[model samples]
Each structure stands twice: as C-alpha cells, then as structure tokens.
Target: MKNGPLFFFGLFAALTLSWAGTVLLSHHQLGGLAPFYDENESAAFPLRQPGVAARGQLVYADLGCASCHTQQVRRPEFGADQAHGWGERQSVARDYIFQARPQLGALRVGPDLANLGGRKPAYDSDDLISLLYTGVIPGAKAVTHPYYKFLFDERPVVGEKSAVALKLTGALAASAGSQIVPTERAQSLVAFLLSLNNSYDYPEARPFVEKTEKKEGEKK
Candidate 1:
C-alpha cells in the first residue's frame, strides 16, 4: 500500500510497453509492405480487392461472419489446414496487407476462408448465392452455413426473368411468375466471400524445413 503510486506507474508502463510491442511494432513493420512481384506470372501477389469485393468485406464484417469462420491459416505442421484444403501454407503478414481489416478470427466454428477463392473445384458466384439463399451446399444433405434469406427478394418476373435470379427448383422454388434474386447486399457478400483467396506462396509463408544431408555415400 505504501508504494501504491509506484505500483500503478509500473502497471501502466507494462501495459504501454505491451501495446507498443504488439500493435505499434507490427504497424511499423508491415505498414510499408508492398505486394510481392512474380516474374513468371508477371503479376504481383495479393492482388488488391476490387471495389465490389471491398464493399463485400464490409458486409461480411457487418454480418459477423468472422465469428464462425477464420481468415488466417496456421502452419501445416501446426494444423491440418493444408490437408483439409483450408490453405496451402501459413498466412503471413504480407497475405493480409491489402485487407481493410483482417478477419483473423479467434475460433474455427466453421472452416477457415483464407484461401476460399483459390480452393479447388472453386465455388462460383452462383454456387455461393445458392448456398447463401438455401443454407445448404449443392449436394450436401445438411445445412453447412446460415441462410441469409433476407439478402434475397422474391418478386414477380416482369420480363425475361432477372439474369441474377436464383435458379431454384423443387420445394425451394419461388411461386410461378416469380423469381428469387439476390439483393445488393447479397451480391456484395457473395463477392466478398469469393474474394477470399490467399494462394500466393509468399516467402515468409513457407515453413522452414531444415534439410539433413545423408552421409556422403551411404550405400546409395
């Protein structure tokens, strides 16, 4: 109790140092990072998100998708992200330099989306829209994700049906003379989800596997 002032000052100092070490230091390190240029592809890594995709990221945050999904992939040895196709390598600071606010979710209630756009057998825009509207994947018997039905509008078709209208069949279909179409938010959200690609093999992302040279000529 006698050293109360000193104790409080020490606590404040510790907190200040922690903040500087984590946040400020990180900003100083990554703030000026530029995209990695690839000679073979003649393009830079981590392409900037398109205008629509950027807006979609806002929608994604608004919907709290990060609560269920993660945007960072751990090292393969640390996790099974590579085996499961979540990502091919661990995410590096460079991977997120272009994101407005990186959604490095804390929990993995659903799968990580750090590389969703680069996933094999990629999910097309229509596929994503259908999944969002139905809460079910194309062939899955169970619902995989929440159906943001509010993002869609069910209305009568005026002319030749909307080009963006949902091509639903079975009981999920809209009533005759009507078509289901994605609203602006739905389009934006889908665009954002489709933009989640981190396939670029940045130097920092690759794990360092030390090579062990076999003895000079151990019986070939």
Candidate 2:
C-alpha cells in the first residue's frame, strides 16, 4: 500500500513538472516574439485602441464565433491561407500579445480572420456587420448561412438616423424578408475583426533604411 501511494505521488510530480515546463517554455517563446515593423509607418500593424476592442472581444466570445471561425493562422502548407486569401506568412505570437485573453481558435469551420482589415474597402465595416447579423448581403439573391437578423433593430426612424451611417449600427430585429441590417453587437464584432491586421506580408510596410545620393547638377 505504501509503494502504491509513492508511485502515484511520483507520477503526479512528473505531470506537474511537465505542465510547468510547458507553460514556462511557451511564455518565454511567445512573450519575446518581435514586432513586424515600426509602429509609425506600418498601417497594417495593430494600432492604438480606445478600450473598445476588449469589449468587442467579449461580444465575440458571447456570440460563439470562435466555434466556427478561427483567428489563428498557420503557414500556407497547413491550410488554405493562400487560396482563401488570409495572408502570405503564418501568424506569429506577437500579433496577439496586446489582447488580455487572446483567442487562438482551434477549428476552421469558417475562413480564418487573422488578416481581414484591408481585405475590403475602408468603409466595408457596415457590409461585414450586416452580413454577420443577417447572414446575407442586401439585394443579394441567396444566402447559405443562418440568419442572425434577430440581433438587429428593424424599426424605421422618423426622418433619418446618423448621416455618417451610425444608423447602420443598432440592435437587430428579425425581418420578414431577407433584409440585411447590421446590429450593434454585429458592428462591435466587426470592429474587432477589422482590428486584426498584420504588416509583415506587405513589403512597403516593412522597416527599411533608404539611401539618397546628390544629383550631378547639384553635387557639392
């Protein structure tokens, strides 16, 4: 009986040491990952947030989006990073260090979102938001995904909402037809999605030293 207890204790100790070692190694490696470029010139790099992204991240988790869409991107060989137009290089740990509880999702039920910021026009946040809430583009003939229109506000206003299209964002309400309205929740989620830009792929954004030479006409 004493031998049994000792053997179990040794096993437990080994497991604990293994887990602790894994944690230490991961922290050392990931915590030290380098930034892709200097913050000033690289628009693709993560920019300063006004404490909104974290709240949006909470919305993302509540919506159960991680179950379908993955935020982490492996190299091209592992998946359709090239074919699906995610990015040229694999996602590194540095991309997500700012997030308190980083979401490195496991499954690929939907396209990866590691690099989605510039994929559409700068104003396409509404489009994505609408799609997320209603599962279809407005005026589109058909849609395959389930409708999340229930998250939006369907009531029409008296004259107009915001001229800047802040009207585009509000609580979603289910509509009879396939009307795609972006909800407040969906808008926040899109805000979080649009925040995931990584600069290393684009050459212009990469840090480099430029050289200049005096012209022949103006030589000293």
Candidate 3:
C-alpha cells in the first residue's frame, strides 16, 4: 500500500527488460540473416519450400505434429541425435531463416525430422503415405506415430480404383469394392514432412573438432 507505485514500476521494468533480452536481442542477431552461399556448389543453403510443401507445413502445424516430433537436431555432444540418424550435424539459426514460423519443438515423442528429406535409403512417398495412414508399415517394429486416418478417404470403387488409391492389405484394407485414398491435404502434409531436410552443412552447424595431440613418438 505505502510503496505500491514503486513496487509496480519495478515489476514493469523487470518484465520489459526480460522481453527485450529474449525477443529484441534475438531479433537483432538473426533478423537479417541471409542464406549461406557456397561458391563450389554455386547455390545457397536451405532452399525455399515448394508451394505444396509450404501448405503442408501449415497442415503439419494444424495437426499438432510438432507436439510429438521435433524439427531440431541436437548437437552430438549434447545428445544422440547424430547416433540416432536424425541428423549429421547440429541445427543452427541459419537453418530456419526461411521458415516463416519455425516449429523448433521441445519434445522427442518421435524421431527428429529436421533431416528426414536427406536421410539415406530415403523414405518412399508411398511408404510414408502408408505410415501416415496406419501409423506403421507392414512388419516394421512398433511405431509411436499416431494414426492420421482422417487424412484419407474410404470410398466405394467407381469405374476403377483411383490412381492415387493406397495399396493396402491386412485389416487396414478397405472393404470389398472400396478403396483408401489420401486427400490433397494429406499429400500436402506429406510434402511438408519430406521438405523438412536440414542437411546443408552450414558453418555454424558444424561441430567444433578438437585436435588431439598424439602421444610422444607414437607415429608420424
């Protein structure tokens, strides 16, 4: 009561300083970031997303996919992201300058997808669709991905099976004379998921490699 005005002013100042430290400082550091151009490759890193993939990124957000999966890869020393084959290098602020609303999620309910597009033995689009439809592929180990069946449609076969109809077996197969097909939104979402590659080795992303001294007279 006696010092109410001063107490309120101190609280307000503290909140303003905190906001400036986090938001304003970050913006000043990263707001003007530009793509890293490689002379040998003659191109820039982190290409812009295709139209469909951009739409799909929105779909990914709308479906709350970030709640389970993260798009960021932790440093090797910080975690086992490299060992898990999620990414070869740690993600950096440059990796996300092109992303309108970067989904740098905080949990790892599923695999990190920052480099999914560049994964070796890359995921087949059909396989990804099936995984999205059923949350698991045939004979694969248990999958934690939630089923996104709402993205597909089960409809009676018209003249012939639609070209886009999914190939299904087991109980997931549609009833006789019926087919399961991915909607345009489903396709877009998959496009976004596949576009989540952050494989470009930005200088900032590269890990610090400490040079070790060889033991005396060990070898030349």
Candidate 4:
C-alpha cells in the first residue's frame, strides 16, 4: 500500500460513512417512536405520566436512584430477570416513549423496576412510601436499602394528624406531639415509582424462541 493523498481521502470517507450509518441511521429509525395503542383496552399503552409523577421522575434523577436500580428488563433467555419476577416481558422502545428522561440504569444492585407497579401483588403507594422512609421492606431484615427520611417532615398535630402521616414506632419515632409526614416531593417520587409498569406486550418486545431438537423418546 502507498502512503498517498488517495489513501488519506479514502480514510476520511470511510470514517464519515461509518459515523453517518451508526448515528444518523439510528436516529432516523427510532427518533419518532410513538406509544402503542391497544384497541382492546381502548387506550394507548405506556400512558403519559401524571404531573406529580413526572415531577417525581426529576427528583428520582436528582437523587441518583439509577445508580442502584435499572428501569429496563432483559429477555428471559438473556438473564434471570423474568424468573426473579422483575418483568413479564422484555422492555421495548415504545415503553419509554412517554418518558421525559428514561432511567435505563447500568447497575443491578437493586431490583429492576420496569414493571414494579404491574408485578404480582404490586407495591402500593403506602408500601413505596414506607420503603422510602424506613429503608427496608416490611419484613425483610437482612436486605437494608437506603432510607430517605429527609423527604419527610415532622410537624405538630395542628387539629388532627395528617392522613398521610407515617406510623412511627421505637427509634424511628417522632417527638411527643409531632407527626411525621411525607413531603410533596416524596409523594411525587412514590407516585412515579408506582407508575413504572411495562406489562403491556409489544410485538418487538417478544422474546425470540429458538427451536430445539427432540430426542427419539420425546413426543412431537
């Protein structure tokens, strides 16, 4: 090969082509993705997040919750995510079409929350609020998670205790006359977590099933 002007021109063209194919091509393909509508359900899948939940998403990002948790679920064959009850089906691009900023985390220190609200015996608002305030799941002792007690406020019982006050006891108790209640930010954050459900089945999200050879004794 000669170290000539033609060789340098060819190299520049190759780099430009590769960059266009990888970056521009992908944006053209998926940049305008829209929500999947379900005729049977009479609504669009991945419904838009409510105003409070949307604000909570900002709080979630600010707190760096994505550092420990992921919002994407892998295919069953690729990982034990399905077996672990993280999600029923693999996540698809349409699942995040309504999100302002999707939190597709890299680490798996905590469970994937892609289908948290759609999980079997789903985590209700109270459950999430309790977890945020207390740091641990109801009965699980060994599994200690981060506690966001700062999200709550201790206030004197003005007329009656707030309906949303945390039922504190033992060391986590508030002062004698004050009640602990979650702030608006905390409520919004919990609302956002509860809105995370990717149970809707998209055609592209279906897992690829490979054919297997059957033994002589096996029935067809």
Best candidate (score: TM-score): 1
What's the residue-level lDDT of 75 in candidate 2? 68
Tens digit per residue, CA lDDT, model 2, 1-220? 3799899999999998998799977877666755456455545344554366677788878878778778776666776775677765567666676777677788877777777774533436766665655566555746755666656555444354433232333334433332334556666777887777763453332223364563544311
Q: List the residue pairs that clash in candidate 1.
A: none
Q: How many backbone clashes does candidate 3 have?
A: 0
Q: What is the alpha-carbon lDDT of model 4 when measured against the actual structure? A: 0.87
lDDT of 3: 0.85
Candidate 1 residue lDDT tens string, 118-150: 899798999989999999976797887889899
Clashing pairs in 2: 151-172, 152-171, 152-172, 152-173, 153-171, 153-172, 153-173
All candidates: CA RMSD in angstroms? 4.5, 7.5, 4.8, 5.5
**Candidate 3 lDDT by residue in tens digits, 192-212:** 878878877776776665656
Rank all candidate structures by their TM-score, best first, as comma-separated numbers. 1, 3, 4, 2
Alpha-carbon local distance difference test for all models: 0.87, 0.62, 0.85, 0.87
Q: Write the per-residue lDDT of candidate 4 for residues 1-220, one digit (tens) a residue.
A: 3978889999998999999999989879999888888777799877899998899999999999999999999988898999999998888888898899999999999899988888987788888888888897866864388999899998998998899998877888888889999999999998899888887777578665466763554332
Task: Give, for candidate 2, the lowest lDDT window spanning 10 residues.
Answer: 162-171
* TM-scores of all predicted structures: 0.89, 0.71, 0.88, 0.85
